[model samples]
Target: MVFFKYPEQIRRVMYTTNTIEAIHRQFHKLTKTKVRFSKQNNLLKLLYVGIKNASTKWTMPFPNWNLAVSQLAICFEELLDATLDL
Candidate 1:
């Protein structure tokens, strides 16, 4: 039997996803006043800038991603193994 002993790691991964999502929501809140960006290019420019600024935050690896991905792959192995599971 495969044993996944790292509950904290799983929690950390979940927490990070939540935290990043919260930050994204904050960005939306902060930009809610940009209602005048009616043109597609103008909105795209704001999105581009937001993404560029957020990209600067990747200073380190998400600690459990390597193991978490492996565990997840194993959990969904049958789905992955099937040729047309999607």
Candidate 2:
């Protein structure tokens, strides 16, 4: 797999679980203060608010994103070209 071959720097970019973990941490932080939710809707609302707040902090582009995309395109040139044709 290309995943096994990529360098550590590139691997981190490809593996986005870290970003997801951060978002989960933010959600946990928001909810940990409260012991219980009055209703499911209230919990949903809180999560929605958390997502909005988290998304705001994502304005900056990922480091080396262009280089990463270029490398990915090179790795999957034929597949990408085929998809573009469709």
User: What C-alpha RMSD separates each model from the true structure?
Assistant: 6.3, 3.2
Which pairs clash in the backbone of model 1? none
Clashing pairs in 2: none
Indicate which candidate wins on TM-score. 2
TM-score of each: 0.54, 0.74
Q: Please write out the lDDT profile of model 2 over residues 1-86, one tens digit for every residue.
A: 96789756567676864778988999999999999998999999999999999989878877877676666667677776677552
Q: Candidates' lDDT values, in order?
A: 0.66, 0.80
Worst 10 residues of 2 by lDDT: 77-86
TM-score of 2: 0.74
Model 2 score (lDDT): 0.80
